[model samples]
Target: MTGTRSVRPGIRFAAAGFILAVLLSAPRAEPPPLTLAILPLKLLDTSGEPIDQGPEHARRLAAMARGLAEDLDAGGDYRSLLVTAETLRARCPDERPDCLLAVAREAGASRVFVGVVHKSSTLILQLFARVADARTGRAVLTRDLNFRGDTDEAWRRAGVFLAGQIREAGP
Candidate 1:
């Protein structure tokens, strides 16, 4: 009978309050960066003999990381590049493992990716994919994931896992 639809004042007020709360609590998203450089990888295999400083180990890890970076680009709308360990060591002969960061900075990358390979019969893999500020070496984000498989397939699963993370993270 009233001019407006008949509803209790408290009910109307509660509905309005809920609407306001939802508006305030909704998530906001931003686009990811446009370019990323995938730096090289190191093998940390523990066994009767070490795999470090060997072409077989180092080249495989580097190729796998590059593959990952390319896969990430598919979902991220980003540019992917390989920053080779040879080029890095050429610039800084006294290269510690972390010196790869400097090369990424040189490549004009906003984000740098790094990984370490751990090999075993079951292939316990620990991959450190960190996005860092190229200049200061400050880590912006990191994904630490593990995989158990034959060594090569472990690389593929880990790559898929990383690509999903990059996509979900919005670049």
Candidate 2:
């Protein structure tokens, strides 16, 4: 009887340990990524000089916004969507937080990313970007980058840097 009791306890301990090991080794399911609406980046040229708002500039802006979305989406943290300037203006006339949040909600996004490129001159540009919670109108991430040169490559690199910052700041 004594030997049987000792063996029973050993079996129970082994069974418990095996169950714990299996549970610990099981793959955990990650939660779905949050939906994010990336609004068209606005240009605020404060250079006090006429810089051509030509097709090239427009193309660069569009590409920058698209690249940001793609970069964020690739990180598996956010399901990024694009919202055009016209759409945002039509939906929310004001730039207030509440208005922005309403626009984000309408786009079925839990968060919104907005940015403005401030051009001091043809050689200098300052980019300000922020991510805000649509529900609370609270900013989750904000970053500003100043880069030299007005070339496509410079703008593209700036977007990449901003995206890396956002990824590090996770949703």
Candidate 3:
């Protein structure tokens, strides 16, 4: 009986060692982070009238762009390409799809985020954002949000909500 008990312990020890060795010998791989380029949001007046959005609104738009890039980078799953609006414009002078694709290639980003903020009415603002494959220019995910007020805080809140939605959608 004692011999039988000793053999059982030895067998368990050998099995555990083998399992550990196999696990250690197996290759471990980590997926590469998604390289993302967040572009500035374009502004449009949906009412077909030229609305003068003052310099303050311009600053707010810039802030939202930076906020989007920061949020995506801090998520730890994406490598955000730090591309300024000027740099992007320099790379692609026109708003053509091909120009945008060329800029994405220049930035070395696998994915690109294009967005727009539209003023539909005096009290209504709409945001449209999309993540597209840089190589194919196909949209992977798109989100649109409407909110009241045109204040900086309102825009910031919208940005936060959009970022959260994008993170949950895994792009």
Candidate 4:
């Protein structure tokens, strides 16, 4: 039975010491998250119907966009810069790549996000989002999703789902 104690105390102590040293020497600080600028969502009517160009629709879309930015920020993967609809309109005015780049540069953001919500019918809506890199002027992430029901709650849920997907996909 005494022969079973082949492992020595000195070796165990050395192993523990090595592990402790490694743990103590490892870097504890993480790099800062990439700054992401969230632009206002574009509301479009794709059903060939005369769309209501009212302020209510614009406000709702802006609210949803803000919620998405907040969700992404809460995920702790990105530093979200949520721009107001009015500011975004005054700055970009369109969802062109060049405009997005300008906004990113002005905001000092590495990444910029733009989204469009197209209503095809009373109960069908399509949401499309794209994130572009300011340095490269290329899209880094893009997502498209459809939601049923013409209610604010449904739109909010879709926004939440999109944010979760973006976060899950990583920065």
Q: Could you say which candidate leads in lDDT? A: 2
Which digits, one per residue and each the tens of the lDDT, describe model 3 over residues 58-88? 8888888888878877887788775677876
Off by over 4 Å in 1: 1-33, 49-56, 96-99
- What TM-score against the true fold does each predicted structure earn? 0.68, 0.87, 0.79, 0.78
Better of 3 and 4 by lDDT: 3
Ranking by lDDT: 2, 3, 4, 1
Candidate 2 local distance difference test against the native: 0.88
Model 4 segments more than 4 A misplaced: 1-27, 48-53, 88-90, 93-96
TM-score of 1: 0.68
Q: Choose 1 or 4, whichever is better by TM-score.
A: 4
Indicate the TM-score of model 3: 0.79
Model 3 lDDT at residue 102 = 68
Q: Taking the tens digit of each residue's C-alpha lDDT, what string does model 4 give over 78-155?
A: 888876667757876765678767777788899888888898887899999988887777888899999997677988
Clashing pairs in 2: none
Model 1 local distance difference test score: 0.70
- In candidate 1, position 60 carries an lDDT of 61
Poorest lDDT segment (10 consecutive residues) of candidate 2: 46-55
Order of the predicted models by TM-score, top scorer first: 2, 3, 4, 1
**Each prediction's whole-model lDDT (CA):** 0.70, 0.88, 0.83, 0.82
Candidate with the larger TM-score of 1 and 2: 2
